[model samples]
Target: MNTSIPLAASDAAATSPTTLIYWFRNDLRLDDNPGLLKACQKANNLLLVYCHDVAAWQMTRWEVPRTSRHRQQFLASTLADLAMQLKSHDSRLLEVEGPPAELLPALARAIGATTIYCEEIAAPEEQEEVAALRAAGLTVETVWQSSLLDPTDLPFALDDLPDVFTSFRTTVERHHVLPPPPLARPQKIPALPPAYAALVEKWGATKGAISSGFADAEPIEHQASNSVTYRTGGRSSFPYFLPLFSGGASAASEHLHQYFDRKLAHTYKLTRNGITGVDYSTKFSPWLASGAMSARQSYAVLKEFEAAHGANDSTYWIWFELLWRDYFRLLHLKYGPQLYRAQGLTSLPQPSHDARAFDAWCQARTGESFVDAGMAELSITGYVSNRLRQVVASYLIHDMGCDWRAGAAWFEAQLIDYDVYSNQGNWLYIAGRGTDPRNGRRFNIQKQAHDYDPDGAYRRLWSAQ
Candidate 1:
């Protein structure tokens, strides 16, 4: 059995001996990926690898798994798709479960790879990994692929990012750093050796064996699952808002096309605050959060729609939401450790801890029926509306007085579309320690429930009322 499948070209000088390793981190798709393209152009042979970091998965401080089965299933589906795509280019994704710090360098040595390419991550732990790779003398190149506007094109230095969302938005709007056009997908990918194919197949067959590599760190018990539900987050998962939509890069693109082509951009503002139904909101956040869809792609589609259909406040609000996402990312980069602290970005003293109260909140036993309903929904569905997210997050931090980090970490463990920057950013904001100019703006739970769920339909659905 020839495991080394020839994809694009087989006759390209096999004896050149230099290989390039493309490390697939969060950016899984081949479309609009600059790092993958650059790596392919530079090397005679390409070895694509997805390292399932056991250390990262196992080191959860909470009882919940850091990467939920919902996320795992989505990633597995994504990798399966990526493998098929790579085969079209004469490449394959070599899946391995281990610390990349050890696995990557060893694989590079084994393949005689001269360069390793991956998407750049700004989070503290991911940066540490990059530093460790450099310390090992491997030539690692990282490209910024997640953000809509490249970091280099930002209006100011990263350290100079504004402390307020409004200020950051104003600066960007004034200077207007447009996102670059999406990168074209390549027609072909370089090939690997027959020995590499055999190694990958053997590795895939015994992936569970390497589960030990990530065993030291306890897995957090996430409530989300891969079973088809309205809240699932896989390629085949139920469509939330925009039931016509699917869950992946291709689906997102199609949604954008119809929204723009049909001039539906004009009604975005009117329907955005809607609590139910698929078309009420853009429904881009889940994929955007996971790096399956880029903000720039959304922007481009919206612009095309506006050109054909004419721009309006509704059309602009989509950009406004993207700006909010960007604002959160910049906030994390600026505050760094402050965002992780107990008091958050605020100078206020940290809230007192109450273990029993915290447990009640987590378990949906809180006496506040509305709050409990939101909690139950999240526990069962792995999702809560943005309005409810604010309500529950505030109740957890202010009313219950739990550690904000604990709540954030729990969100990290459960959310299928959790982004480190957004998860931490929103948690800090709710804790009254973030960039929100109004400090400690805790939501009134009863008032919110009455307002958003007047008939108590939502509460009834979750069995919390």
Candidate 2:
């Protein structure tokens, strides 16, 4: 029942040389990566490379920078882990800070690599980079490893995709196009070229820039000055949801095993909306967003759980959420440029933009106490409850009438688990221009605040002024 796919003949041929390059992008892990596996199968020698595009960090149409420190910290941790993993396979991840378009191909040439293997990204900038690499005459092979459902196996073509999520979901479910099982980690990694040592040394001296667009109250001061304990990166992140589940892939796998084996899937429907603590929701999004876990792996575990424990509404709901994730990703692939436009996809009523109002929202100085608190929480912790995300997004689009793109950009800059598809899709949905049939369905801000935070506990924690 595995659905994993390998590269095409031409792509395989490109990697048939003595040395091949595996460029790590969003698919950061050593496990279940088709591109990495394929590269391992084809090459006798391999060079792993990661590029931090400085231009991407600095370029901003909105006020915020693209890569926030929170995301950078997470990425840095993951890269460190990835390097360790690669070392076991006899390869090392070469970290570089430059545009991939120029740097990747140049690095490939420098190391005498005939082929490049990497994950495929549908974003505009990534697509341009791919084109640039092809134009440079290197054999570039891309594996579609990002989504739960492969686009080629989708029920309908991208252009003909249903505008509504339910329609897309129904059609896919009816077609029964289940995702393939996750790929296993490759057993042996190829050796690096002798010259790669020099390239690695050159990149080692480059330091990552810290941007103010995504700063926080300094961590040391937060702990010492206020007697407040904050969970920093690494293993501490999952512990915050203590007594529920562990963090990282090993923890995620164990949680999946227990949920299926112990019939916890049956209870998910009852607890998914709970406001506080770990068991409330799956807590899989952060891991899934970063490629630490794969949608297919989660699905396989759920299916096994259902087979053993019996399927029910709770089991179905997990798939429902995963399908929603897939639907949003497809929407991104389908709309492409339109999704990035100021007006979004729908020809609906537009919001009024006032710089002063927008500035207030960004600065967490908005007059509404609840929305202001949520914004501040987002600024300081890089994490927000799903309830608050919808509430704050509604407040930004409906009450303040700010441009949705601005708000989406702010989330992109702030969220630690910001996936381009989910961030943009959710924003467009709130703005009434995405998959929603009813355009601009605004949430009742006051009612939501009262219902979700009746005692104002969340507000008290985050309200700056």
Best by lDDT: 2
So what's the TM-score on candidate 2? 0.86
- Cα lDDT of model 1 by residue, 96-206, tens digit: 877889888888777777579998877878888888888888989999777777778897999898888888878888997787988887667777744696667545424
Residue-level lDDT of model 2, residues 262-336, one tens digit each, is 666788877775544546667677667767678888898888878876889988999998988888888878887
lDDT of 2: 0.74
lDDT computed for candidate 1: 0.71
List per-prediction Cα lDDT, in the order shown.
0.71, 0.74
Q: What is the lDDT of residue 85 in candidate 1?
A: 72
TM-score of each: 0.86, 0.86
Model 1 worst lDDT run, 10 consecutive residues:
214-223
